[model samples]
Target: MTPAPPKNFHTSNPETETAIDRTIPDFPAAQLSDEDKYFTHHKPPSYLPDLEDEVKEFIEYHQRNTHKRIVLVTSGGTTVPLENNTVRFIDNFSAGTRGATSAEYFLENGYAVIFLHREFSLLPYSRHYSHTTNCFLDYMTEVNNKVEINPQFADEMLIVLRKYKQAKESNSLLSIPFTTVNQYLYTLKSVSQIMEIVEKKAIFFLAAAVSDFFLPQSRMPTHKIQSQESGGKLEVNLEPVPKFLSRLVDNWAPSALIVSFKLETDNSILIKKAKNALDRYQHQLVIGNLLQTRKKEVVFVTPSGENSWIKLTDDQISKEVEIESLIIPRVIEIHTQWIENK
Candidate 1:
């Protein structure tokens, strides 16, 4: 049963207002493009220096293997904070299933993976255990004063564990966490720039469901919004998030194979939007999927105006075959051709 919310849960006492001024400031128009203005005004995440250092170290570790391929897999949904202190925020429905699953396949195919994902979202190897109906502890049993994997789950668990161990032993997988859209954009730019040394050997698998709108820092309230302040009404005005795919394709990781995802509820416009994104950003590929059938099928759109569908048969779906198992191999095939042509 759900407990009732506390009284005045959404309101604050009028007399208890803090000293921080809540005035909305006016600003003059700027000549800068929305993308330029966004990065210019919004401060980078405080942990960016450490993140850059970590990425650089990861890349340097793999630098000795000139034939190695690296894929940056962005995953999960980005949050749009409503206030500077962030008591409330907006989020999408993505659970990072596609990205996490694809990362595992990429690792299996011998490509180094940079898994940039939302905090607490599903990850590649551990995803098999998390976000499931069974509790993680349920997969274990105690016998003879020792904890052991339950025989029922041991077979599958062993396979995932072995793969996870191999990835760790080889240091082929790097995980980066981001929560807000701002952090994701900054981290993506920094990581892509660092990956520039690899040239055509890198792949940017942009699967993250980024927010299309955001509450700008300059406009965000300093404190949690109070219902009493507005007489039980609240209004929020969000600014359009600057599209950074062009910057990513043109400036950051220019020689890399950039594959972006296009998710739509309407199937009719899915291919159109996917193709448009490729033409606009000049990216290598776009994976289009319907919201309802994403797990069963996906359409690949390339700049050459060729489109193909990858789908799971009823038998495959019933047997729990993941579409990413097919998607990753096709992406690798395209990447191989792309590298040779370059």
Candidate 2:
């Protein structure tokens, strides 16, 4: 279940409480067209080559053999470093539950999954037992120098273990990890380009809580900023991240079906903002969710200008059925239609 909305959460009109966070710097006014400058400022992640290799191998093998649909699921929260060394940073609020769970459903529906998630966040299959309240050790007990699952949790653990093992044996899941927004952007571009080989069969489900503000390399200090500066008060200036969704749609993977997420605190403008994004990015779908009610409800806005909702029933919640179990099948139906139209 999703958490309750924060006490400060409001339902003011758009004019009063805009969905966008103003503290995050707006898109560059002077150099709005300089996409290359953004990439040059934040260097690529160190693991780019290895990540690309894995994605390439996965895509090639699937396209050659099964030729089944492929979905790229980006999850978790991305961080924005304040300094080059990165002692302090800003973080987005996400545990990656939506993305990770969705990946398992995609795989179960016969699609190979490429899961790109924030480091140390929840993972598919293992998420049920790896959360903060529970750990792997909690479900295991060692006796006679042999480790066995605790009897109480054994039934559920065995089921998850079997699914995880099956995915591993079939080589249907490829996991790539990232921590910062810089790494996420580079990895996303690389993955999109690689997945282009699948043509219309590729789907991009971008559920990551990406940061809106970042300290540019040019403005960031080489070392950590000390607390003594300015009487123990620090002032930070950040720049808005470059818009790359358009590039993903028009250049990197033109034929792919892209579904971007729009997370908002206010329900009033949730569908409004989601529709705006579909118009702006020309993507296939936008999944609109509220910060507090995300796991229980979501609004789907498509290019056809229809706004539909998926809500979890009280019975479903009581039965321990996840909302993703409903979201993924609807998405698969949309993807099937997309392929047929192509």
Candidate 3:
């Protein structure tokens, strides 16, 4: 059976913008499912078929004639809706910094990437400037009826633009978007199953901050929930999301090099929880990080006991060197070794 929900669930109204309660209720014995029924009953993201078709074409192209490796990089945070119409929802605090940055490094290392990310989240190449305080518009100016990059930002923009164009022209990056958790899971399964052709050469970088609990569609009200109707207090019962990592490791893409991230606020339990996940899922690697220090440091846990830490120096961080710059190369090295041993 799946575990209980995490302790961070809350209820809020849009107008007041204040959380009334953060107490998550435990599931009644009757509400629990023996197996993960999340994918079974929830209506899929409507865009699943289109995303699958795009990925199918992308994977087919990569499988032929070229020795290029393929990777599925999942990024950003998935939403847990409170209602069928989704007036309110629970969200994670991920901007997809790791996944987006890592995808860029993978592309730099000659890997074709399938970037499956939260809708409107950060992306490779464009990610540098897209979600930052100084966005694309801030770096551009209108010059003689044509929009041109400002002279101050031109040099860096040129490098980014060239890399983006090169990836596009080479057909090296295929981006698919998702908003809700159901969409993420369904699309992940489809993409992983489709990637069976590449076998061990395929890498699954599961970096998305998936929600731990969600109100099932069956239980969610069909319309927007009214605060007045509910006696001015809102209570929600969220079910534990199924452990799909087990399915991904044991069934979905068994031969693939799978690496997952474990984020916790507490320092004491971070490594322990990550090691536990490695033991449970039997995946290739689990990257454990504390919420406060994730960008500066992460520990890699493996079943073979090759546990190690990766950290960025203050100097490196000041130089604008993203940790992912260090991370992806190490992961590539590990993947190479895995393939060789296999």
Candidate 4:
């Protein structure tokens, strides 16, 4: 005779339990909005505690110098995992060129930078050599059994290296990486809250290309889906990602100067959508750029209905001048004016 099952174990029939487990219930539409339910139901990332500690330390270090303004620059793209175990994922398109370049300029303008970026994306200083046709090895040479920067690239590399070292020595640049959308959201919220110590001196540059939709954790499969079991055709249902910009503005870092980027394929509706975001979020500025012309031009949209275009001249483009070089200075000007007005 077998020993009795534990008292805590369910005595329900196996078939009934299996049937109930297969049914995934939809969220109640009348009770709560998806956004509200998201935070309530979803669990925070496992690495959040470690991330918070690092951010707190970084912020505390800068707080010692009251005059130092800190900018939290988010870069690259977030991924939406298809499964709980994460065999496949949906990703946004961003090489982190804008955020990385903007960060260097922010540092040059005497701001401590907290770079919250997607894992493995291009980074400042190193970004100059990454994601290019040539490999990093192409810029290296082995002479007298010692490795050195190739002579052709040494001059440019030297300038970037000096700035990079300066930033490191001053302890002004803090880099934090996130991979999935969940991790990104958690990290952003935690970092922003910690930045409250700096109050009006903080700036949030939200340049990351975040996904508009994602599979909720409750509905995700525990293991990777087998193609054979599904008859070779796969269908996925995704829910709209919460609009957290409003939360960021109203709750997270209310006093911080917030700047968001809008990239669109259509020129006619770009300004309209940008203005909508500004009105909706009540943020300071929206930087709008077309997908095709983002490298050469961008429009600055403000909450007060002020719209201005920042474009690179033909000569500037030919000279390989990055548009962020111009974008950052204008942003700094606006930030200064905003701080003074407040």
Candidate 5:
């Protein structure tokens, strides 16, 4: 028998700013939202079908180029919504500082990034990245991939890539941003698709705090704390958190070098859980952390059962030095070794 969904499942609300209660609503929808509505092709999340054609052209265009590899990294936490058309919700305390900061490190180390960002995160979108395209084939190739990720992120990346391709101007690569969990999933799927055809071994940072649970439907009525009847009778039904990893590892990125994270309520149980994460997903690595902590001290667990811990004491060491300095390089180094072994 399946477990019931939580009462509180707050999803991303792009607008409608209000104080976050981290509380779930008290009602249940008999029917869930039609997942097909969100997708370009009527599926949950969405897919960019044009990305493959672009990657193929890009590979041929850069057949003799000296580029080592193209890396796609996703960072930031996901929000939990009480219902689909999210008004009141629950979300992680994460500000997306770690993921965004780490993205900068990846860019500095010379990896082209599909840096998926959430709103109000550390990294702001960079226009400089849009000015680096050198040719039609080159621009079209990468733009094609960028465009398919999600219109929100693709728009920015495409603008930068297109401008550079047409003007033959050199510019920095961009950090493609998205607003909500749905957008993140769509973009992640697109990047995974691009990496496969290009023969690129991607370094995915499942740093985003994806809500483990989702509400039954979006159009459910706004839950009222003060009910019309107070006689101790309420019926609320729920669904489980969407299984992102099952689809990502098993189907989308079967051979990619994947890194996952596990957040535990108990620190003592973490090591065991980290090891379990590695075994469960067959990922290259698994990072574990305790829930609700100021310091994001994490344990990096390898598939062979090796584990490493990084404690920052505080996320920001100096004015300019942030947590990403400690994290991104480790990811790059691990990714480097993983590719070499293959």
Candidate 6:
């Protein structure tokens, strides 16, 4: 069942009482008055499926049952909408191709994937999650091959979609499709809450070119805006969008190996920028994404000074020419090794 959208803030919200005695107990403080109005007026959203208590335990069971580990994978790009109504948005160059292709690789490696993707042009693996308390996975040693086949490298994903068609008859995954920065924030917060509850070490990909800033002062317009973008510059107050790395490492999934991305404009300072990211988030690796080009980039800055500066440059102008082929393998190597270290 879809839950109601978060509540509107008021000075006298009874739920805010942080006293020792309460049912829900210690709910987060209300947002700034500005955020209060901005969020409440918007429609509430449903999330992708969560693991049943039984399913979560089953993941644990699979870990013990098979001795292989489960890792969470999140990808895709975020959106920043222009209006309270998300009809129009300022989009980024991220097409979720990197994230989707990487996810396919992870699935091919036989790891359970807890995908938290946004605007993924590609689809995810099946919904028939195995037994676990709030988890989804399937393990096979001499696994059978009836899982179907298609363009997707991850047969699991293909099977899952077709299965969803059979089970839900075209019901889509819980896509909290957000176009505004706030809308993305709202959805991301819920994702953080759930990830925090998860105990395993996960592999999170910050492939999404999350907007650095968002409308700070959003209010219910008495009338709808005729246009979202204008020729001239009209400034709007904005707040920082949430970054999952710091919070995820510090509080949410400390055990889960972390891999982050850094997008740089200047090539000379790319490593410096990546080092800053490593210091900022304390991640194991950072994929440096150069702006404005899709050619296989200077893939560097993994672990304490170790890196792959190999340039798989593009010549022909097809989609594959612009994307990273070894990106997935390099990530798989680092994560597999990281997990082995632990």
lDDT of 4 by residue, 1-342 (tens): 111211111324444322221111233444554544565556567667777778888888888754689999999999999988889999999999888999999999999999999988989999999999999899999999999999999999999999999999999999999888888887787788789778888999999998999898889999998888778988999999999898788866888899999999999999999999998899999999999999999999997788999999999999999999999989999889888988
lDDT of 6 by residue, 132-195 (tens): 2433323322236554333333566556566445423312122224434454555544444344
User: How many clashing residue pairs are found in candidate 2?
Assistant: 0
Model 1 misplaced regions, further than 4 Å = 1-31
Q: RMSD in Å for candidate 5, one decimal?
A: 14.0
Scanning candidate 5 in windows of ten residues, the lowest lDDT window is: 1-10
Ordering by lDDT: 1, 4, 2, 3, 5, 6
What does candidate 1's lDDT look like per residue over 264-330, in tens digits? 9998899999988888888899999999999999999997788999999999999999999999999
Per-residue lDDT value at 41 in model 2: 41
Candidate 2 C-alpha lDDT tens digits along 196-303: 878899999999999988877678898989999899999988888878898788867889899999999998999989999999999999999999999899989998
- Candidate closer to the true structure by TM-score (higher is better), 1 or 4: 1
Model 6 is weakest, by summed lDDT over 10 consecutive residues, at 17-26
How much lDDT does candidate 2 score?
0.84
Candidate 1's TM-score reads: 0.89
Looking at model 2, the pairs that clash are none
Q: Residue by residue across 1-342, what tens digits does model 5's lDDT show?
A: 111211112323333122221221221233222321232221223223343344434433333353535555555666645545556565665666556556556656755555566655545234333223543234343354563343445576776456445322222233555555665666665556545543435566777777665544453456643345657664445455555565567655666677777877887898898787677767778878787652457778887666788866542544435555676679778887877887
TM-score of each: 0.89, 0.89, 0.88, 0.89, 0.62, 0.62
Alpha-carbon local distance difference test for all models = 0.86, 0.84, 0.82, 0.85, 0.55, 0.51
Q: How high is the lDDT of residue 233 in model 5?
A: 62
Per-residue lDDT, model 2, residue 56, is: 87
The residue ranges of model 4 lying beyond 4 angstroms of the native Cα positions read: 1-34
Count of backbone collisions in candidate 4: 0
